[model samples]
Target: MGGVGHWVVIFAIGGAQAVLLALALWRRPVNRAANRVLAAWLGLVGLDLGVKAAFLAAPAPGLFRVLLFVGVFPFLYGSFFYLYVRTLTTARRLAWLDGVHLSGFAVAFAVGLPALLAAPDTNLANMQAWLAGAFPPPVPWYSPFLYAWSLSYVAAAVWRVLRFRREVRERRSDADRVSLHWVMAMAMGQVLIWGIAVVHDYVRPAGIGYFTIYGAVAVWACVLGYLGLMQATVAGDDTAEPGAPREVPPDPPAAPPAQDEDARLPEVQARLAGLMEDEAMYLAPALTIAQVARRSGYPEYLVSAAINRGFGCTFWDYINRQRIAAACRCLADASDTRTILDIAYACGFTSKSTFNSAFKRETGHTPSAWRARQAAA
Candidate 1:
């Protein structure tokens, strides 16, 4: 039948992509890896659109579009899968491999060498036959290779999430389940999009072309990402309601309106920083919002307000930053006389697992590795 259905899906999908990329850029302090990966993925999206344009207008449409859609785009999918997980979980961890990532850039240079060359435009039937015979869905070799590269990253991210979930559940540690949910949300989105694409490849019907298949798949992705972002915004609020009255000293005029975000933010940041430097609220065995606020001569309500508005990190991440910050000192100091558990507890973390996870979040390296690096230096 036809390609390029309606104006709405185009605007809708494009809007969703822009919103996600914007939110990721605005909210995350550690999103460089995700940013790089998203940039590459977006570039692929552009390439997909370009090939579809060529399919409509080119005299050799069958050849050029087939080569691009089958061989080139499939390889790009491999890179996209790797980057999406890397974007969500370990942007910092992969920073060292920047040089290796750059080496792949010199791949185009290899085409000039005798043994290497770029792909030529091929017939649609021949390309389809090539994909069907050699590189099928879950291609055993192709699809799974991208997945294998993500395996360790997935495991590490899952461990942090589950570990954080356990801590929030037990009330023994400060990390929350929100971050866990965020990671899981991203994983589910990836699986759903990729899963449909794989299924469509085999169960192909006559009129459902490559552009339509990818367009359909991307529609689902945009929907899921939109829903996830909406939930993240709601869940990020520390207070139950935006304009609800805060815990006051039983006085009406003395307390300001609950949602005075701009007026309170600087005060919150400074007070929270003071609590961190002075009381070392981070190092307490069971630090509570009540305790920190009281120590700072403020209400617990005000403290939560400060945390949510000023830092944008949850109370969990906020306190963990302090504990993790302390852990860095012990890590750097080289305590021959102390154990990791001791350092962990001393830094206000209740358990080794919590300490290890939080340390990784703050520094991207494990505490032992950090210490070793210092020692090596």
Candidate 2:
């Protein structure tokens, strides 16, 4: 009964992943490379899970042990994830050097071929021994190579996600623009699972570690599926083309003759205020300091400094204050009947959670409570 229950869980997770992969692959206009890479990653995960389920249900010798080659997929899947992040963040075509990341899997397969081709009796004995906590001697170079290769790629993926976050924050006021928070969470989840698995291998050496690792993989699949479906585009999809020259902001006008730092500060502050107030550029949702700088004909650093010195707050705080102020007007207007979410979005918020928190921080009342008080008055 215990074995049956385990098989059931495995198959269920595998089946769900398969369905998600198919939907992602077949879903719409076939233009997005990120979607394709994501689908491929899901496909490999599903394959890994399916192989595990089959091997556990009926632990055969020759075919099942050969199927164990699929175990190397953690390395492959990690590469796929790295590529997916690259695609989303840069939209660059895969480079030839990217193939080098998979060299570990190739080496492992080459080293394991002899064991896979051994007689059925021999393979069966090996499998039983492994299940009994008797791991075979590590392949001369392949074991350490796979470990280092896989760990490096996972670390790279985490770094890529962190870089993506910083880039987005620099360019846009909306932090959730590409749902990068979810991507970062997924990458960190992989790191944690991999780290724990490594420790378990050294300390426990118990076969139960396989179940724990695969179980985490299954959960990771579900999370990726949910986030992938929620995302309309992985990133802005307006990434600069590979090797294309970036558009430089036209240089700010020369400083007026003899204009000291103190004298020039107000001019910068006024221009920033004009952009935020008269144009309502703050409602752009992704407004960034660099953007404000470009539009105001000021250097990025000067723009940031002006906001900090003149407004007495960070760029994010100043922008959110404007958004909250706009939200307050909409909330107070008795003629406006739009839902809070609609108002939130119209006022440049990307998500309701952000809207609520900012509104509360700035106004000291939730939108609903503030709206109620206004109505009563």
Candidate 3:
């Protein structure tokens, strides 16, 4: 009965991974780095399943199952760690050994050193003996230390998200809030999975009891990878501090949710139209959200919200689009009397530096290059 149940559980676990990998491949707006990591995990799991299934015809030793289980845990855990961070912080850099967090994870995963060098451990007794002498038997301290360290990594992530939530509350921009909240959800869910694994590690039977959580761990791995693959769609709130969420906590309210969804969109589109009509908002040297909102007649809160949610851009980007549109108009009219600076100031830009930056980001060229190219054509 136990054997039958374990097979059923394994099948479910494998099936879940397959579905997630498929989703990762198909989902658009994916982060390329995330996609690669997920695809790799999918392949690894496929290989693991293939080996286990091949052994079905001639049942392998229970020790073999234990070893496979131990090995799979780290692979899946690492996948979860990568995918979750990749998805939540798309466009942000996360070096493999960015800091103490990942380094600690690397150390924790190195715990299985003994099983590698010992001659084929055909059974539990041999495996135990090999482990006992392998670098002095793991004391009770090892188990607790590992558990605390793993949990702390997740807890720290939660703390970061909650901090973002607080900042979002002040802005009250719907788009800003929504993006932060989405990231918060992904972070918290990942943290919950880690919490479960840490608890299992603490309470499980000495040998491989915690491996049971390995199957549950797949749930998070799949979700995290899916998030990574669809990261393009997941918004990062503009109001958020430059860094992404580092912890899971209550996020501020979602950007003011529209009671009339369709109506809200049109209203925002109208605001975008207005931003294009003026040179003042575009030319402001140090235009901030408050200033933009004051000009738009929409609350800075609403203007910021619309920029984030309706336009899918930050206020900085939103302002630049207007400046670029105005510049294009000037180019088409063949106006030479107005120096670029004159035109930039006429468009509401206060500084050449600001206007130039906006123009380059939007048009993929400096203002001078853009004008020269247009004239040549």
Instruction: Give the C-alpha lDDT of model 1.
Output: 0.54
- 1-377: candidate 1 lDDT, tens digit per residue: 23344423553455456456445543433344454454455445544544444444432534443434333343344344344444444323345654453332233233222212223433444344433444233223544443444343444555655654543432223443234456576555555555555555656666544555566545544543443334321112222333566554444224568667557767877988987898787777656676676688776667777776667766777888888888788878855558777888888877677788889988999988988898787
The estimated TM-scores of all candidates read 0.41, 0.76, 0.46
Native-to-model Cα distance after best TM-score fit, residue 364 in candidate 3, in Å: 49
lDDT per residue for candidate 2 within 86-181, as digits (tens), equals 877776757788788677678777777777776878787778876675756447565456667777877788788888776655446876655477
Give me the runs in candidate 2 sitting further than 4 Å from their true place: 1-5, 12-16, 19-31, 119-121, 130-137, 140-148, 203-208, 238-265, 286-317, 329-343, 361-377
Question: In model 3, which regions exceed 4 Å deviation?
Answer: 1-27, 30-83, 96-101, 121-139, 168-172, 176-212, 222-377
Residue 127 lDDT in candidate 1: 44
Q: For candidate 2, what's the RMSD? A: 4.9
**Worst lDDT 10-window in candidate 1:** 232-241
Give the number of the best model, judged by TM-score: 2
For residue 363, give model 1's deviation from the true position in Å. 39
Question: Model 1, residue 336: displacement in angstroms?
Answer: 55
Worst 10 residues of 3 by lDDT: 169-178
lDDT (Cα atoms) of all candidates against the true structure: 0.54, 0.74, 0.53
5: Cα error in model 2, Å: 5.8
Which of candidates 1 and 2 reaches a greater TM-score? Answer: 2
Worst ten in a row by lDDT for model 2: 233-242
